[model samples]
Target: MLVSFSPSLLFTRYNSNYSTMESNFQGIVPASDAPTKRKRPTEAEHIPTAPKEPPAPEFLCQDCVKLDLSKAFSVEDTSNETTKMAFAPGRWGYFNAWAVDVGHRYRGTIITNCNLCQMLFNSRVDEGDTKLDGDGDWLRAVSFLEICGLVAYKPHRWISKDIPFLMLFSNKNYDLYENRKKVRHLIQQSGYAALQQLNQQQAIPFSPKVLSPVFDLGTFQNWFDYCNGNHKLLCRSSKSDLYGTHVIDCQDQSITQHEPGMPYVALSYVWGQPQAQKAVNDGKRLPAQLSLLIRDAIAVTQAMGFRYLWVDRYCIDQDTPTAKHEQIRQMDAIYSNAELTIIAAAGQDENYGLPGVGKNRPKTRMEAHIGDVAVVWAPKDPQAAIKSSKWSTRGWTFQEALLSRRRLVFTEQQAYFECNAMNVYESFDIPLDSLHIKDRSKSYEYLRRGVFGGNREAEFGRLNLEKQGPTEVFNRYLSNVEEYSARKLSFAEDSLNAFRGIAQQFWYGKHAIHNIWGMGYQTPPEERTSSFVHSLSWRHTSNCWDLSQSPQRRPQFPSWSWAGWEGEVQYEIIDSKQKSWFDNLIRAVSVENQIDSPTALEMIAPNPDATCIFPVVIFTAAVVPSKLISFNPNAASNKRWQIGKYKANLALSSGSVSESQFAEDIHDSHVWQCVCIGAALKVSFVMILKVDDGSDLWERAGIFAIDCYSHSLEKMMETREYKSFRVR
Candidate 1:
């Protein structure tokens, strides 16, 4: 079972309403314990307004209010109680800090409202006084006071007297002042000692403590040296500067031509808008007029003991289209051969620069003192920041990040280090290693236990997919396609170019697969025909197509190929039981194209012009005229179609296909040709327009599927004779 992981899951928001108790509880205490008598203060006396801030000695207050509920409350009262508790003063500020601390300290420990009130009241009570019980009259009196608004209570629990856990908040809406103060305190106290202690117990190294605003050169140098010596892959690749036109020399800060075998750092950032060019002359020194991002990259490269740095704007001669195209072709090698890739993943554009690099760095750490010991809080994970950054969305940066052997990602919160082997965050003490574990739960447990006893060779062997079967290779390609489709491309034409490197990898590398027009590929020579047909079985996911946006068709690209679209795409899985039935239906497949003509299929590799064109293959499959019966009558407007007894869903193609024809075809069966396309989750078929064009080709209409267990359809499909047609 292959488990899919999303960045959203990694940075899931903390649920504050979660209960720590084994059993659910209603927040309300017994009515019998309610105070029967109360003394009212004189009207003339000034009632203190809700405290502007949480009570001083914040840690004490935060530590005192631990709640443990006894019974679950009715849904109606729970809602009412939650609203009433919102009246608590200063709950979102310092009061929140205490709740967060307690939650982190005792994760999954449930506390009831009665127990929580007793804890808070006890903290304020005299040193020798007994602690109030959950049902105590004193607790009820305090609750009454809180309910009456005479005293403010922090709203920490939901209807169930359970307290929800607090995950670190994004800096967007947090109080920076308090956060900064706490961060400063944490840094001052032995550089996140508490976090370090936790990490040590977990056997994960704590993030290196940075006492200064900027990165420490010495620390970076040590890390660089360590990686160079320990990581074989980092040291194995030969250095080359052929891709870039100019590289900044760290020694004299001069712009110079990239020298082969000289190590350099590549800068990956988003180019937000057209900026003034800082072009370099052959002999003249590099311009000092660099953007903040470029300057920071230079500083980082020099600090990391690298004498050269490659930045696209300065390195590639954008003035010459030929030169730019040539450099673009070497994009994969450029990043892969570099010492390290510096990712500016925090801001939207180049002007934002690298955080903590300049003097005006934003404060990201917070600290609070608990007796003699200090507690610190900072953004626990910088991965969220990196994943959500504008840079991650850009088409060019997608390949840059993936191709790079190692990446030092700078985010708004902190820097993170990633490589093929492991991922480390500046805020985390642990480094996560890559393991081919399909079970998500077990993978997490492995991380928690710091288990590094897995077979290294076996784990690393997974990358060499050539040794594996075609299924593994196909699955990897599909995964890449899934991720690539979700990314944005500035220019729609660059879609194929941006993803071409991955195609090249699958083609020339271990997979040894022949690249198709971003639809299918040729695997083993014997299975080439089947592979081509199977690749066409992709479908548009629910969020893939934006019907409002005008669809642009790339030249030489067929409507069947995903590369023809501008959004995400997913392949329909064929039914395992129906796999043989669908395969047997396809008699042959022959792909053909004009030998000298430029087609979309030719651009399926890293360098399109250099890649060989796949001969146009003629597919011979069982074709039958079938009418589509929509499961929902409103599907015409909704863009959904169903066929056969299984009511398998089908995605309609955009452009040139007539909706009127589809409506007419369902009423009169001869217009729809169900061309069998291999099976995965179900028997897959492509519905082609039956109209005769001057040429021998037929336009793709839509894709549909049928269940293996559909006896009537299977029998009907078996009766049809195999027919051959050319796919343009």
Candidate 2:
């Protein structure tokens, strides 16, 4: 349970609910050791009635609060949003530290890198040799001044309780004085830590702030009521502790019913998000999942003898508050009751295929025509010729790679059913002092104990780690496939380089005028300053010496735009003629943030009332069979697309095609930049794709295609997955 402290009690007191929590909010001023008066930025003497700041977060550690100084660096933070510029490496690097009155101590940090942080924390923890409940929660308290940056790991003890008071930062730099002052001022305010903690637990971390109306999760008259609160249970007095794990015995109105199903098994799919998400083919593949990921959840459950499975979408109403809370709170039970949590581990190929995480693989249509592929001929006889057709399948996708590997662990409550499913392992058995397959005689003893329930451990033993190590198999298969891909990429890169050379020369040939087609070129101020017409004798040289638009057209170099380069500004390019001749004509058009490019096909997590619109342009003029994209929306939006199983892609020409839609389904662990070239293309973004309104259009992202110039590959990453993936 979480307890809030009051500012009036001073930094030393740890109490609940300070009455003066909101009294006279003060600016965060640094704690001064010297008595001489100094003007701190937070002093009321500087800015009197500044707008009230959000509640200050308290440091979340017992060591910090008790001034132990030893146990520090207890911060829990969420990964950076992919839409944010900070998430470049496709992962989040959290910095956790412990702040105190004396010196700063960083307890630990968790990330792909920064192993030192974890190593340090673990070392400190091991030195004490104190055992903790494996969940990592040991009640600890911290104050505002005692902490800095986002808490890397909130004390597990506070879940469902008041959020452990916390402090977070926008960037890596932490200004001690400013941070200390902010902490001091908030500590002086009553209930700042408490209320903020209270608010944090009731909401999703890092999500937008929205006050949803409370909902009533009541029973309906239907056979489906089997899973909901029974009439007798619902009739129980509100004081009754009716709902425990999965049963919703109505405690009545005091506790708002969030969803119709108060307690039910949630058999939703969990997408396996590897820490590194590495595969053998990823050029520099780091760490990878070596397992069999179940791509079909429904199929897996039915395979386990369960007839009806209750998934969140089919069992609850997401749009309602009652539904959300009931489900969110019931998450613990839903999974516990679930027969199994099937993870999608389908690969791009049945056996050997690299994942589809990088840029889209664009192949020209003509490159696929392999003539050696022959079909049996039909004979004009009584017997019809055997149906003769030869077809080739496209290469695998990253999304399929994503779908192919996952881990499923049964909670204590669901452990009993391990054997009920098709899994190859089991746990909670008897000791194995002399247990070995070689000791065939031990099998009878183990079986005796397992059946008699005499010594579950000594008999059944823990889950056999050795049974069916398929993930290793997956990795091995990937190794062979990656080698093939590497060779293919080498060939493709050569072709691409050749095409690029041709394209550049044809578009900007040696004799090509510099300014006529600089529409997409963004010249810096230094270049523009020189080009600016300042000679006062006449007019703007660019306007006066503009070349006729007719001369700009080329027989071979056609632009993607149908709009002629009219209404565009002309720049002066000094040629052999002493008098400057304006040849470089450019347009000043706004560039879309590139939010809806292929990178966002369906890999987005959004707040309610938010929709991510991705505008993708498939180059119909270019190659390969057909392009397929995977649209895996984040968990909030459970969307599905039906393209049937496309064995082969249709020959595409630039005809109108509907933008396929899939709601966000699983949570995505990585974020990358979406780059687009054209500044002339108009774009709109929304948090959700709906009929009349947009959830939110985020224009804050400062993304651009020009940044790619700094990147080595100078290419944007893009890929798609089919909607047929049964896993949500």
Candidate 3:
């Protein structure tokens, strides 16, 4: 005989033992058993009854209902303790243990016996059922419970691979899941189709058309043919002007003469540590020893149907200084004119070959799953990876990447195809329309025009600079320096040499702007004196301006130029909003080039030894009286320099200038000369200085500024006589 178990029977059994158990199992009291008597409250003893809560929503489950109570677990104590524990550890611990056991048993039962749970575990829902409230809600609840570790389910292992098991487990609503699934499915299918197109050498229709992932040789060939046939700008080069002395013949698998205009793929990579690789000589055969990177590049070039490949290690003779210098000068054109550039951005050194180019290339995906959805974690933006790569951080590689017209970047995540018109990746597929392509093309065209001249109208129009003035051109050069300064170079002496290509491009036809040292090149010859002085007003963006902190590695360059520093530099003179008042006050008296020593002009060939030529500029300027003021708020006495009726503050630290001598000057002499003017509005004046040794040569001592403009100072400036001085 089996005993029946019912809520009424259970309540009846526990009703006699505990008064709180008088209610039904649902925590609801029967209407007949509820209190009927009414209690009256006296005027002196007012009683406040507890507020009643509304019934739980019908949509909630039985477990949800139990957990939804405001105070589900509570204890009433009749002891002397003032603070009563709401929940006892021993009592709740037992209930928790029982609940865990019951949940485990239920999970086992669902896994082994529940047909509905098993059927839906790895199955894709139909379109109609996907939107149905009952089906979606139930499936989502089960998935959420599993993800939260409240339930044990292995849908990914036992179900279909295409099923998106994680979608059901996601906390997002049905509409979001649907939209995300559609996009993900499209990307997945496009990736598959791209791989198939490469392997089979067959074209397949892909949706949303912009995806261009090059996984194999066949796909790369297809893209190459399409670009060559369609893009008018991507014209083939004649075999005469290429700069490399040697290039690897992809077809013959041997080194050959580098012919100009020959269609060859160039490799951009990091050299890493010095490797004992064979260099090309005056021979027709390939080197016996080759770096892994060069070998991989050769293979890729051949596979992509190119007959020749240019790599720095084999192409340029590093042992010969003359050959290296000449090649370095032509680096910009070499990369810019390449048929295609292969960037090994993911690799740290030459030993690390391009992924997917060699037999031992590492695979990007892992065999993992979340539910039935085959999870693939790939970089969403390959350009970002390329930018952050070790290759990009190197000084030479920056110009290489910027100059290249088209590039096939091999990143750690995936391959990306980029040209002036568009950038496409394997993981994401977006079609390239003419308008979008044109937008991208215009940007590159602008950069090219700025570096390599094309139509000047578009370039000047974009920058909104006056066509006659070189201010925008100067700013553009500084922008290049700003980026180049942050990059790393192995040899400090190669600083100017590495930047020579870009410098040549910037100063292409401008005869007035001479590439003196590095700073004076941007200034016109007529204004060389004033411009050179203005250019000296550069400040370190990262650290305080200190001459001692400047790197002495390249002492051939002067401390006044940014080329002397090993870190980033920014010019304060380029602030366009500021009205320059010092340009007219200072005049260039004479400019001379000093070679070897500080006091000589000699004709020398363009040799490495002769490259360290410094310009000595002489200027005539009106000197004004100024003083350094202590602006430190914590100082004992609030002292400031009185300029006429207005008080002025020091712009730079006194320590950066004269140290203890600055303090002595402040105590001994109340006068200081104003060397140059700075940003307008605040009307900053750079303090003038005579060397501590009492030499006629002058330098910038410090900076001082007044809060407001004073017409009285302009009258005082007219009364002052101009003095001549030599600047080194």
Query: How much does each candidate deviate from the true structure in C-alpha RMSD?
Result: 17.3, 33.0, 24.9
| lDDT against true structure, model 3 | 0.45
- Count of backbone clashes, every candidate in sequence: 43, 69, 8
Task: Tell me the tens digit of each residue's lDDT in model 1 across 347-429.
Answer: 78998878756332354333333333223343534544665678877777877887777778887756677655444555543
Please report the TM-score between candidate 2 and the true structure.
0.17
lDDT of 3 at 604: 21
Question: What is each predicted model's overall lDDT from 0 to 1?
Answer: 0.48, 0.21, 0.45
Residue 600 accuracy (lDDT) in model 3? 21
Comparison by TM-score, 2 against 3, better one: 3
Native-to-model Cα distance after best TM-score fit, residue 247 in candidate 1, in Å: 2.2
Which regions of candidate 2 are displaced past 4 Å? 1-99, 102-227, 230-305, 308-728
Among these predictions, the greatest lDDT belongs to: 1
lDDT of 2 by residue, 1-728 (tens): 01122222221211123223212112112223442353322211112332222112231233323333223223433343553433111012222333333122333443312212211232121212254233232222233213322222333432322222223222223443444544433322211211122212234221111110110011001111221222122111122122322221111101122233332222322223323321111122111222221212222222233333343332444456654554444343344333233322223222211111011111100000012211111111100000010000111111111111111322111111111111111111112221223332122222211110011112223222122132222121222222112111112212121122112212222222111111111123323211211100010112112333221211122121111111111211121212222111112111122453332212223211121121111111110111122343342322322111211111111111221311121111111112221211111000111111242221111111111121221122233221110000
Consecutive 10-residue window with the lowest summed lDDT within model 3: 93-102
All candidates in order of lDDT, best leading: 1, 3, 2
